[model samples]
Target: MTEGNRMFIQDKRSYSRLLLMLLLLTALVSSSTRAVVHAAVKVPDTIRVAFFINLGTKYQSLTPVATLQSANGLNLIWRDPQTGISAGTIAPGQSVRFAMDGYRALLLETTDLGAAIAVLKKVQASSNAAFVTQLTKSGKTVYQVTEGAYSTAAQASSALTKWTNAGVAAGVQTLLSARVAGPWAVEAGSYASAAEAASAAAQLGNAGLDAFAALKPQNGTLSYVVRVGQEKDATALSALQQSVAAAGFANARIPDAVEPYTSLRTDMTLNGSANKPVTLYAIPSGPSTVLRAEPAGSGGILLTERNKRTYRGSMEMSVLNQSLAVVNEVDYEQYLYSVVGAEIGSKWPLEAQKAQAVAARSYALSSGMGFQIANVVDTTTSQAYYGIGYENANATEGVNQTAGEVMTQGGKAINAVFSANSGGITADNAIEIWGGDNSFLSSAVPSPDDGPQKGLLDWYYVALPSGQTGYIRSDLLENSGQTHVSGAKYLRVTGEGTAVRSKPQVVSTVEPVARVGTGTLVVQLGKVAEYSDYSWIEDPMTPDQLLTALNKRAKSPITGPLLTLEVTKRGPSGRVTEIAANGVPVNVGAGDNLRGALNSLKSTLFSVEETGRYTIVDGNGTVREVPSQSGSLQVIGGAGTSGSLPASNAFFMDGNGNLRAVTTSPLFVFSGKGYGHGLGMSQWGAKAFAEQGYDYQYILKYYYKNVSIEKGA
Candidate 1:
């Protein structure tokens, strides 16, 4: 084609290649520049801190050490020395940080060197006794500062004294006056030549003490004396003392008691019947007290005073045992000694404190009274006194007067009870005696002061003027009054909402039989003097309604003489019949007897096959299921119109005791009798028996096996 055309093509290709190379170079340069511009900037300077004290409050002043991502970003590791509550996490933007003041130091990190310099400037501007300095002495550059350094030992001592004098508490560290050793300027190994003194000073400094040499004349030689200053000798002494105290030496100074505990004191009176004396030991500090029983060691025994006695059967003493469990009681021979000899601390010596402890122990034992104790110093005299339950156990520890007054612990109000008729005092009588219609203000029977009654109630029991042993409501009986019923016994019944009745029927039942529902959670209300038939039942209403009602009371009604029950529910039974849809006749086989077949048909079909009839009600109220027949009707076999019976069909007994065909398409009949399982009390039957004059107790016995009717608690 021609040399000229080839040359043109070659030239075009060369120019295109040159253009591509230039473009590639340009793109590479642009990319490299972009990367250099986008690379992360160098991180700046950072600061960190450590804590030196615990400031329980004032959280914001603490400076937590932080890691800096940039000037605007920070990662905080905040630690509160006071509360020991610490947290660490990344933080962005300037925000309020929390830490304990005077208890923590701030650790800071920054990317800008300028920012670090700025922070130092701020520290310098504030008079908060803080500053930053780069420690060149340490090979590694460390920022540190001198805080409140004393120039001399005398200066530090005076400073501490001034703080105490001004009531500017530095706490035990300053209060107890602890001292720390620091650099001192003193002469060591005096010599005529300054070089020798300088060498000695250098040597002492190398020994890790801040020492200096002071040249002075020593006999015939010029000697140098090396002295160390700023040593906190006081701090070491204070710390040692604290350590000793914490190691259980707080009471080591007091002499150990050599006397023995006393047990079984004589001449004690029951309920103060005869004036008696009981000796109790005073703690080492005058009026303080501790209880110990004879032959018993420490720790095992309860805090009971030695030889603290009332009487053999004193009510207060017994109650004390219940509420204030004297651990080392003379319950056994070894118990007395085991509890007495243990190490009892001096804290038990304060009489007021001990009394409070006793009262508290009593409450714990009896679950009755509530009490507290506290120490008080008479403002007028600066003397210590104890205040207990409004009075002082220590103030009058030795003032046990026989005739001062029959003082009740808290002034006995009316915590006792009296017993009376079946239902206790009627609502009318309760209102009259208690000055209010308070139902809870019921009475209890009387027993000796030392009787089994652990707590006081409003009720009591007494013999009637007529020699009746029945319950007479307590509120009606005064302190010394006597009244009784003809008879009394505890009677109760068990069942979930068990029904109590006057006549044992669903109707004519005005009151309950006594609800023994959920047989547990019982409280003794009172004894039964003579409850009428179904008189004082726990629930005097419908079974479900009564349960709902009883739960609303302040306390549940529970009495003694509880009866355990076993319940059973009756099942369905009776007889029913089925019938054919059409009155068509079917042929019977020779083996199928007519009577047997008819009996089976009686349950299988409603039609009376023997009479060819069915019992049906007509529009006019006339009964008619069978069509009028000419003569004595009977089931007869037929052909054509009648359907033939299936083969292999058999008759069996149904639940109703009726014979019928056992097939997929079968009929059911219901003619059940008896309300429930014929196991225990039958309401229907009870009514029948009651109609015959049988009493409630008689009815109970007749139905329940091996049970007796007693008064409830």
Candidate 2:
């Protein structure tokens, strides 16, 4: 059917039929049909959204040290640990005391810098000068990393020796730049008496060494010391120390070191002049169970101090991994209102929003995800369920119009899984992503899944050399006068898949377009995509960063450095089902596991390309290949730029004026289409179908095969 013709829906006849079915059900209520009513899916009046799980993660970084307060005074309860019964109400707005009960430091030993950084950020609260030290493991080039700072050189030295047999925590303390000399001299030797040092200095002077004996205070004790080489310049001092070592003074060093600087207490975060104190949970002790807080009125909304957002209904704070995991139990319809706004978004026709309501509603009911605490999470983990702030009139109308409607197959609610985009074709949930087969879920080439680039964050439409035209995500595309949609979008051409043209032409990409369909978003009938996460591009990941993503994300985390990252297998929809890290299959049971790892790329359908790889021989004659630079680097022809490379310790300033670390360069760049796993209905496609005049029922039925919209039991 033509795109223009879709405006007319395949009507299910009339609502009179629905009314008749309801009347029939009511008439049979006292009979066996009543049991069937009880058995049929019942729409919930309320749903719990696990807003924050594993609270310390960046996925929902509202607070690392999590705590929340309601302005209208909270009705608090401390549940008993044994019986899970509330002990009683507690005073509001008062500082509650909590104890540090369980805590264990996670120390990772990995191969790459990126993975190390991922763990480093987690271990040290995003502090780059993390309370971490990377040490080379014994007999292996792999890094053994940990969280902590050195208090003393002796302590630092001890840590290196005591680093678990894993070989982490190796290093001598920096000693607060002790090697720097500001009118300071090196201590050649120390003795109990000045006469002993004087005799030693005289013998050193006889050997033409610059040395003098002097009495010095050593931590409130007197000590005779032989000092050598007076120099105010740190570089000169270092040179002199090397010379001294050559002259048999092997252990000569500076003394009386102090800490480099002071930092705010661990709980509080430092932000310029203000110290953001981390709130302590009042996980009441003794008879107290778990902390629960609610606003006074049933319909009242409470604002949390932590994220500074308002939530409807009561919030229960439960402890998970020594952090607060918050669940918001809000009215079901209210939740859908926000989900529609967050998912379908505004400015997209009301029809799309209604379709979203039905899909979201059915998915929530059938997900079977909640385990007593919450039915689903607010994150993309379930669906983008922002609270009241995300609610809009258009979305509210959609939910209200399609109230209590859900898709059912075989008299049961279907798992109405959906993604932001489809990269042109939806995936069969069972086979494409999960590697299983399901009759309820099937793939379809929705006209709206143009490509990941059609409406995503950034992209480049290029005409491939093979004469096939497709869009390339921004990351893989080179700069060629690119233009992003700023004000309004225009549909230059319309077909099964919308041809969105913000402008006639702009920058394009290199790697041939993987695939294309009706990928770009459609505005009211004919306009360019306003903002859709159809395609996405992740910045180039240094080896360290890539490995960090893989390890942090993989189920059975990869232990060593990431040498290679390649998609080993793909499902029908071109969604990745297996990825090989360093040539080994990564244990990612679900595609999202791999998705969450590599910096949370939009979807499993993606591309990984190695950039600027070069082989180099180190001073130790260790030959290895590494990426060229963090950013771009100009290369010279083999015959032109011929010189010995600098030592690894040499430093250089980068384009950003920051000192580049002693590392080679970024390894891989990732780019792809689609937002979520390519499964079930594509939200972008729904919007397209709606723009084409299809009703909510038609949209849901098309995406969910053999499904009918029916009311709850």
Candidate 3:
């Protein structure tokens, strides 16, 4: 028949007619006619059950098979942990059984009448044994193997025929493919034809294995594989395997070993004290991984479990430069206070502002050093408040005069690229830079003016083979170039030969900032900004400058609005312990004067308790009524100061930062800290901390209360 007519005739047939014919055929073949079988299989509600048989392997992530007795019909459960529950429909020739222990369950699904009859004949013993006796004894084909090398397929088919003739039922398949030899080569098993080996060899070229005639030198032709990349070591490979299994690739295997690279020492200081050593987790190629540490002396806590978040006291922060071991979280906070305090002033409320500043820095650093902290200081008192500091709760008034100007300029340049009504430059937008004479160079990036480039202003420039030069615009350009640069970015040499370093430097990264090339993602990490004339630039290879530039794009906020609550009275003396209504010795800022003290309380109080609310009195046979006025009383302790307060629990904080309230003698009821989880190190808090300078170690020490830092096994 013609191809078109064959297709039409085949398409015209209906499935209902086919089923009717099949039923009539079956009835004619049988001596007596019986109703069409509709075997109903019972499915269980909760399919999770312990097996009576022992599994040789300790763990099987997937349950592929189960066995049950057949009363009216067979009751079987096939649960694929990865795919959830599957019930009904056991078509002939398809496997419903998955792996149990050492055995397989004869799958109930099959459409083949012969195979079904064989399955019915099998005894109720081991599935494999029963299947062999029932199917093999019947002299029929029941399985298949196809789609590999022709030689292998032929061998399988012949074997199947022999088994079938010997009264052992089996199925076989035939496939077409050139026979080639390779187990290691990714393309070893694949082939167009034997004659195409040379072309394949030319294609492979120098990527390790070259195609050879006949899989020559079987021993030498072992597959060459890139087992693991430079990012992993032997220990890491094992962990990676575990992760892969947990991710559902249980059958996957890792290569035995890999070549080593020039390793760098990664020192970790989690929590404040360096006395305790931290275990190193596998490092990724990303910017950095955030870690957390609890209070000093607090017995070691491991944050290695997947998805478990914690605070970090110290970190082995990674940038372009070799990592540096740093000071405690508190010290970092102190350094920030000193810098900002010096920038603003060291006066009455300013001193108190420093404590709050420390708190803010600590909080941000705990999270992850990927956020921006807008510290709004009370310039008059030298005291800094968070959201409500300089202006209102929204910090609308907080503005960095220098940064604002740079932003305005950046906005104009970006508007030129994305078009006029494009709004301002965001970290998600791609930024392209041009060189001298309005020539475009480099691909776009997510954000402009990041970390190291924070202070430096960016502009378009035309790049040359040696370097680049260009003009920056304050207003929208009437005619901007739209031509794209081709090939790898090249710099042009103007006067003297410029020194070429692998990365940005403190000096030169700035001058060439406008000359970013095609592949330049963002300004180099960790270079200092230098300003000259009316232009700002960065050192490309300088680690400091790059870090500074990256920091600019960080919108993840480290410090939240200054938490504050009002208290009617001071703790014991003029010092504040808990709010007047509730007793939660939370972090309290300090100022030099009374107003400063009150301001500290206002900015730092996490939550407050209502003192005027009535307290329900429930006693056994005792009915007593208490006045509503004392409903919210926060108990005060004799010892109270800012600096010396206990890291955890209730502690009196005086103006000098002294920690008092060693024990909770008089219980005080209260609500405090945005989270009942406490201050210093929230896992969310840890990400916040890294945003500032508080590394993982600092976060750990801040939250975990006192213990001891020692080497962990």
Candidate 4:
């Protein structure tokens, strides 16, 4: 009885031990699985980009280094420091521990295999430390090239400085996703000739397979191989093989490691000769400290003033005219932070800011003309880019919300040109400014006044709050009545005179002048005058001054002195299409030239008038002569004056300030309307529209017809 009981107890103890072991194993397996899932979910798809920096001037040398006191350390490998080719990976720690004063990298990605391969080859040839990676996204292959990776975005910015130093085109972008290795491709066949391989590829492609001909070296011989489809794993490879067999390709196999086409050489170098500009790369000696450029060559390091300015990207100092030209090269989005505030007031509404951001982005990313070292200028010529000083919370928000968004037409970026106040109506692209049909930049219908009114003159009547009514010409108003309402308020005018009876009528005592004083709030009645740009402005120029300005701007030599100024033709916008000065036709073919010829007269819509006092001729010494007492003297050939000079045209002012008959040159006056080229989006108009509850998209659509706002590529 004792032996049987002992055997049963031993069996029970063994069973308990085995059960405990099984439970522990299950817990271990569950923990491992959870860790894998978490990692897969946590890994970011794209890198967090801080900003892009542009080196505005050519540099002689540059050096990048990690700050000694920074937690985040940089591992940089300069492929060609002079040419700005580098490769590095950052040890993540602080947000911006290492600061590269004048350098930034641009991560560019391409879906086009050929384009990607070309760029990779170019970078590899130019940069000794260049790296290229391939990633599969949404079942499509993408290739990416990074100039350098840094611990903090501030350090990574050195890439751009290097690129500019190498004189590379501003084609790099900062918005890029992390690259992952692509899958293996199934090779269908190999042939000695590319033409033969291409035929096979075509056949496979026709069978609904993604096929391409790639040249590869096999057994020391370059052979063109045809590939069908890419497979992520062995199971996918088997499935792809089966599909290829079914598509009539009996011999289809997946390579263990498909080598890239031989056309993309492993040792390919940059195509052109490297003309490395003089570059200087600065590194902060301590964390959160100002960066001082490491001196290179004979020139001592350009010491940047600490805390002088806070830049979003990096600062690039170059010698221009023997002085330092500090250029802040920041990322596209960061660049907009200051641009929006500088272009339009930061106090503008969010929608207006967003609209301005898009327009500025489009303009900056357009043709890349007028820029050598940087993408844009810090002025109206390109776009006002004042850097971090001008950046405001609202402007930054607008940039962030509309990040990577641009206005495009037919899948291409449009010009997105804009100006301050379109007066009333936007001008036609073909007729105004550039004299060509930019399909997207058509006339935008102005508020209150759609298109243009035929009968209304540019002049307007103003009723002042000081119990005075006066005739105010269109030019006197802040903006054209086109975008403004008839009863819009204007600045107060203390002293005023009589209001004209009607538009196109001369002001005289018969009209009854009403005296005005302080506290006068003038209000625009309506557009009662017709001229270019919705207003009439007079630009008075002496005969000599007119001739000099004209000759300076004329493409060809303007031989004669000022004689006759005539507007030969006018466009529908009332802008002078063709003009002649002194009978020698002024080349008004280009809008800019026309504007300059007219002393930069607000607009081309102008008429020239010559005026001088009339006098009578007499024998012996010239004496003062007045017309008959009943007859009034006439001032002929002046702006807005219409009359012929008398046959006795000799007239001069005597010593006693009396009129005498003597020859004298007449003063020329140019009367016109509006400001700017009168084309595209008007900044003031955009603000007005924004105030009226219009969104940025609506504002862009209104100005750019047949255009779509889409995320940037």
Candidate 5:
């Protein structure tokens, strides 16, 4: 038997819920706790991962919480997970659909436009990120507004002043698809009154801590304990202890024993027909319900049959704002095996896998209850944890060899963030990648892959009007060989508002002697702008397109017309440190937010430019020539992003030495290296490094500064 195979287990959406009030599905299971159970500092042996939380754009689609079954040909049982009492059994290949029993959402909708506007305003007043949707009702179009996916009609009515539907909805937000921190918590004293306990929890929460009032029942009286944060290893517990002390709750308490958690009452629909309020498990008992529910299911069982995904451990069903979360509570090492395989592939070099295993472990332990219910989620948002299917002998070897080992810095677990590729140059932890913060991640240095991976350049060396040479993109120069103009005057301005400088470069924005629009004749010039690709690049984002994206994803969206996008600052490796839109510094959240806002850049090490306007398409689906005047020019073709055009127009010069002017429309070209934030260990770089004979220790040390691979919880 494995040494420590214990059975246990963001969306960025504003669809967040109150952490403490989660998992209560009806009056069936608010069972009383005996004591506050002041826990001590200890590392967790099992990890609870919340999986298959399919919440997306509201009401587009909803993924049903599917079945859980055993695949190892072992018999499974449905049980009251809290008491570890078996309620029923699940046969091999059979399924138990965790149907919403007490879980229900009250839907609110109104067809009238005026009513919907008022309803949306009232609902959003309370600070829930609610929105209105135009959907269909009984073949007639209706404008539906909502508050929370309220579990009861009374809650829905209370959210708005008028026109509340007393109707119940089948499920919560219809998501089309499924999509951490230091593990430390501050627990205050228990109170006899739930209200007082909630007040204390809110006090801590208002202090910016993730505070939740836990129901710790005693004798038959309802007592509550104010809990904050999740489990943390001993090394990191000291900081949390001090933080709680500063937050006014000094006595340090962590979950070192049976962790109390809220339970939901879900109907175990076995074989799609019969339903019962039974806790699903294969074993009669092992551990407590909320923390670790040891399921005796066999390996390879179809936990989510619809997705053909299999998982070990037990599945716990709960709802956040009525959105269903199927949490997989599994052993920590077992989870790592799947994560290593899913992240770097099962066939990756063993040393690389080992490095990944240790990194994943450290990352997991360093995270708090990310989903508010689980320590992590089975996604890249936390880390790639695909479940049992991705587990393999190679990955298992990697995990087993590095069992309980994590990367620690200064005797504490570091964040140990890793990416697939670091392009060529790694992002500087203190500046480039996310923003100046991570001196711990300073190990992210330049990485070398097997072959050409990062940015590559190919520029045209051309002679200028004054007989000077510079590097520029070849598109800006085409030798006609047939002198379209006359002697010594053989050039046409391809782009409107093409700034003519004394010297040629990739692009120059400084004061030039003159500026020209499309077809404005000019002699050839020099250049120094860079254009490179990864052989596989995403669709280019234009200035307008990027402007829309900036508005959509930036923390402080450019409310006014978006025009110019320029990289104002960069890190050591030339990754964007700061950016400007229309000369104003953008407030895009650090890390991948800039990349995400700019239409999902491969990485943050990118360059953006006003590459002149591309093919112009107006609102009528017609491509327009360079207009003589410009009030506003919206372009299409490339991602269809919109932005403000240049203020003035460039003039075209005829062969007879006459001049004609036109509009200035420009595109923003983004080019970069790598495929992620470029921080920490590069997985692909690790593979290459491993293949080049670097051991796992060397590989890890290369990416994490002053880190020592050591064994821990």
Candidate 6:
């Protein structure tokens, strides 16, 4: 009886096992088929990205990488190619792949295995190109064709053109390969400190040379060397040295091979002070972990000011400005995860977020500040970085999708600056701010209406009867025009009654105070200076108040009261470029400083109004008014002048410091529009463009004229 029961149970178990094996085989086949189909339709890989968990720290925990692969069901195998020995399985929460070094390869596409074999044969016959065979995730076989393995990107790029032109459709891809040991580099200079080396590198970059500061070990100590280029082979090295020499570096020479050093350090110090010992930690708190700092001696814990300050990298704290400053040294892309949200709203359109990510990445790469350690600040001075608390899902996604991407001009990172808004039009870097023509940074019309006006008669510069010179529309000129003034550099004001309004004549403010009186000339600095979204703000200051503000901000002393306020010079946007107070000429500062000087002034485009008369309206629908020439007047209304009238028209003091009226009346009005320095890609303008169905690339192209957006490393 026992033998029969055991045989029946064994047969049932065998049937179950066979069924499970068949199901597993079917799933495996289905997965392989799906991968092949996906590979066929997928775009060719352009980059091989090495995601770093901590940027500056010598030790990087591969936990994030493992976690990412596991979460995405990706099978990643790590082994030593030389020894052919298996290290171990890279499981979730383990840190293994720490090095952020890779090389770019060209992936050649083929219709089938036969086609790939044919290309490989042609490559071997035509040239000594190296080709690697591998199957893609989609189970499609492809060949990675390379001219030669190089130590530096410059050498790789120099060789890419030759292989691509060999009659093959190929795309560049990044591969995780060991760097060939090399010491040869085009040396620009060597410095005793990192700061000096960085300065030299910047100078070389300014001169259009690609240079970077590298730490080299010399005579038992480390020295910072400014390297213009690094090549593995002698031929490439010689070519670089010659090119740099031709580019004004007469002393550029190939230096002997030096051992490469990693920028990451072993341990990071936190709040190291003479009085207190250095505190070292491996990583910051995880996303779910609450942040708490322990006292130096006491075991007691103090909650961090920012409790949810999760960071992807390590941190170092130092005593800066007599206060503890913590710097988060994180991967370039992870840094942008926090930055994109802080700079622009996380809820912004995906395209807008992508644009911001690219701009932020370019900005960070071009930055030289803190290059010795973190490379950037955690505040608005660089880009407002609030760590993981400010990071959102969408923002992180944007950062991941645009990983390693940056804006480039002439094969180098461009200074991609952006602001909250451009006030409808962007400014040329040369004309508005730094005063040097950057072809990539030019004035761009963000609005369609900003284009030139049509059906308008020719404009001519003319001298008016009152001696004012400005451009006058042909229709506004009188018959006594004497055949429109010929070929003048500056536009001249013509006709007897023409005046310069704050905006174009149509839809302009009706207040006479808002318009520059007749006789003041106007020049065409740029396109028509009119913005429909122009804003207005009022800031009234008494003679004494104006004197106090001017004295506080002016580089030179501003004494006495303001006898007169006049805008002596204006920019192309009609923004005041120069102003005079009490006959003292003050050159308006560029960019944000223009508004910082006068805290109340929103923008340089403004008008000042002084009124000596006031109309007071009381509660009971009764009104009483004071004439401009009134000396001592008594209000006869429901409420006295003190409680009646708007705050804009408050009390005023006579020249003798006497309170002329006890009612709200006679106040100066300052009306203006816009905010911030109108330059580069405007945040609001980007949002508007995105809403109009324009992609981030189009928005960026519109603002940054003549710039290309390409996949970068």
**lDDT tens digits by residue: candidate 2, 429-533:** 665566555566657455486633443444434332223333433333233333323222322222332332322223244332233343333111111222336
TM-score (all chains, Cα) for each model = 0.13, 0.51, 0.15, 0.43, 0.54, 0.41
Better of 2 and 4 by TM-score: 2
Candidate 1 Cα errors over 4 Å, as ranges: 1-6, 22-127, 130-231, 234-713
On residues 232-341, what C-alpha lDDT tens digit does candidate 5 reach at each position?
Answer: 23465666667767878866476553343332122222211222233321110112322222345446546553367877776665444444446777888998988998
| lDDT score at residue 99, model 1, on the 0-100 scale | 11
In candidate 5, position 167 carries an lDDT of 24
On the 0 to 100 scale, the lDDT of residue 537 in model 4 is: 38
lDDT of 3 at 277: 22
lDDT for residue 446 in candidate 6, whole number 0-100: 48
Q: Candidate 2: lDDT over CA atoms?
A: 0.54
The TM-score leader among the candidates is 5
Q: Which stretches of candidate 2 lie over 4 Å from their true place?
A: 1-39, 52-73, 76-281, 285-292, 297-299, 303-306, 318-325, 450-532, 551-568, 579-587, 612-666
- Stretches of model 3 off by over 4 angstroms after superposition: 1-225, 228-400, 404-573, 577-667, 671-713
Clashes of 5: 30
Evaluated with lDDT, which candidate comes out highest? 5
- Candidate 4 residues lying further than 4 Å off, grouped into runs, are 1-311, 317-327, 444-539, 605-609, 612-665
Candidate 6's C-alpha runs over 4 A off are 1-310, 319-325, 370-373, 447-546, 600-602, 611-668
Local distance difference test scores for all models: 0.25, 0.54, 0.24, 0.51, 0.55, 0.48
In terms of TM-score, how similar is model 4 to the real structure?
A: 0.43
lDDT of 6 by residue, 31-66 (tens): 553221111111112211112123334322121101
RMSD values, in order shown: 43.4, 21.8, 39.3, 28.1, 22.7, 29.4
Ranking by lDDT: 5, 2, 4, 6, 1, 3
**lDDT tens readout by residue for model 1, 1-713:** 69999999999999899999989999999655322121122111211110111122321111211111112332222111222111122233222111111111122222222333444344335323322222111122222221222324455455444433543322212111223223312222334554564454345434333333332323433333433222333343343334323433332121122211111111111111222222111111111112212211121111112222111100001001001111112221121111111211122223212222222211122222111110111110111111111233322321121101111122221111111111111112221122333222222211111111223232222222222212233323223221212122222223455443322123333544333343322222233322221122111112233223223331323221111111111111111111112222222222112112332211110112111222334357955432332222222245535342332222333345443332112222211122111222333333344446654334333433233222111
Per-residue CA lDDT of candidate 3, range 472-518, in tens? 22111122223223222222222233333321233443443334333
Could you tell which candidate, 1 or 2, scores higher by lDDT? 2
Instruction: In angstroms, give how far residue 119 of model 5 lies from its true place.
Output: 28
Residue 149 lDDT, candidate 4, scale 0-100: 27
